[model samples]
Target: MYVAVKGGEKAISQAHKLLAKRRRGDTGLAELSVAQIREQLPLAVDRVMTEGSIHDPELAALAIKQAAGDLVEAIFLLRAYRTTLSRFYVSEAIDTGGMRVERRISATFKDLPGGQVLGSTFDYTHRLLDFRLLAEGDAETSSPTARDSEPEPEPEEEAGPMGRVLQMLEREGLLVPEQDDDQLPADITEVARSYPCDRSARLQSLVRGDEGFLLALAYSTQRGYGRNHPFAGEIRVGEVSLTLIPEELGFPVEIGTLQVTECEMINGFTRLPDGEVKFTRGYGLAFGQSERKSMAMALVDRALQADDYDEERSSPAQQEEFVLSHCDNVEASGFVSHLKLPHYVDFQSELELLRRLQSETDVAQPVEEQA
Candidate 1:
């Protein structure tokens, strides 16, 4: 057990200095800029932004840089920074149907209205390291590949927003749709904790939850834990305009364009009171191009809705308290990281108890031998 000590202000300060030095290793090498991280490590920045519950890429990159690329630390930094900002008007629910889609695909359909758009993805690429990238990383040591070596492909035809896959099912009355209420949606960030949280609150929590945690839970559902005959309805990644209507202006105004990934899962159908069966939807949305996170979120969403569908809720994914309470990386990190702090007193107490038990055992053994 480590012994607790006091009077180390100078030592603490020196340790911080040492930490900074280590974070900036090898003085001879060029330092990385926040811009470089924001542009090059875009997926990392996107993850930070999504789980951080903040949409600013520049700030996320800055936090990543300051935290020495520790993403959980970066997420924590972003959340703390968000507390200082003033509350503005809440934007209206984004109309993703009209998204300027860059990538659109449907697993259920071989060919949809928009056609399968294979945008920038690593899905087809072999898991092999290009030595050229290893040799000339950001330095660009080699000459550029000649355009003349390969035939130029024909450009894609101009098209407006692609059609939604769910619309097809909805048209046939095969999929039940979410009822839209006129009331303002719940502000999950400001709302106080309460039992039996609304669907809005649950969704808000899930979106901000850790990607890895959600992925694991989603995988568990597929492995028969919370089995829902799930089919990926659609997955889309694109930029959408954020719009808000002010009380005074009485008209909607475009606020900002945000990159987002959305996934929809068509789960096993349930027979209603009218004796008609309709497929259920598990919706997932994430900031930036986070297809995996969105898909996982969708699966977990369906699992969590087991009660609503009159299905047994015995799975870990279906347990709202377990999933919501522990999915946050920032919270999980804080709980685990606290172990690094001085726990000498607690350990000493444990050691004392162990010693007492051992002494009692020793005394009992001697008496029993005498008997």
Candidate 2:
């Protein structure tokens, strides 16, 4: 025990030093710039921002570097830093209808007014690694293709203000009308409480929840646990403007725009008390090009709503307490890592008890007579 404790202390110290050295790489090599990470590794920054519940890309990039690229650690660092800031004002809820869309798609209807715009995506890319990337200065820069001598045909008709597909179903009495909530949303950061919370509070917790945990829970649902057959009614990726009302100004003003990913999931219908069948919906939104996270979140959100439909809640995904309690990577990391702390006192007591029990057992046993 003494050796283990001493060795662990030494090892931890050396490991930290080694990590710092590795993170910096060679003294002759140029240090990695935070700007590079923010620009080139945008998805990593997105994950940090989503889980950290913070909106600053620069800060997220720094956290990623400080944490040596461990996304969960970066998220924890960013979240911790967020608590130190002062709240100047709360922004008005964003209006997605006005989003300047870069990408939008619907699985429910391909022939929707706005034909699917497949933006920058890896969906059709072959998974082969380009060896040319290993060679420096191989990046090609080319100008946009020249327009034909003939005047460009009139641009495809812009889809009149893209409306939600689910809204159409609701209009036809095919889906339940959305519940109106006048109560202020519960802020999980301030409340720091357990489950049995409202949908607003639950969704607040879920947006910042661990992506892997949410993904696994969502996958379980697809495999028949808390199955809520879901169709991606719409997944939109774009920039949405934020507006904050300043007390001094006495009017709302645009702060800035934020890149975000939002998903609306349509689920199987259930019969109401009035014997009317209506479709259900789950919604998810997150920072920057986070399609998978949003989709997974939508699935889990619908799964956790099983109680509202009077469905069996036997699945882990459907149990609000179980899912919310274990989904924070920060909490899980601390609890799991705490086992490495010194437990000498506890071990000593157990060791003494074992010795006493063995002594008593030896005394109570008879010596072998014939041997």
> Candidate 2 — which residues are off by over 4 angstroms?
1-15, 140-159, 362-371
Worst 10 residues of 2 by lDDT: 140-149
Which tens-of-lDDT digit does each residue in 211-316 have in candidate 2?
Answer: 9999999999999998998999998999999999999999999989999999999999999889999888888899999989999999999998887888999899
- Candidate 1 residues lying further than 4 Å off, grouped into runs, are 1-6, 137-160, 367-371
Tens digit of lDDT per residue, candidate 1, span 199-224? 78788999999999999999999999
Clashes found in each candidate (C-alpha, N, C closer than 3 A): 0, 0
The weakest ten consecutive residues by lDDT in model 1 span 151-160
Q: What TM-score goes with each of the models? A: 0.90, 0.89
Candidate whose TM-score is highest: 1
What TM value does model 2 have?
Answer: 0.89
The models' CA-based lDDT, in order, is 0.87, 0.86
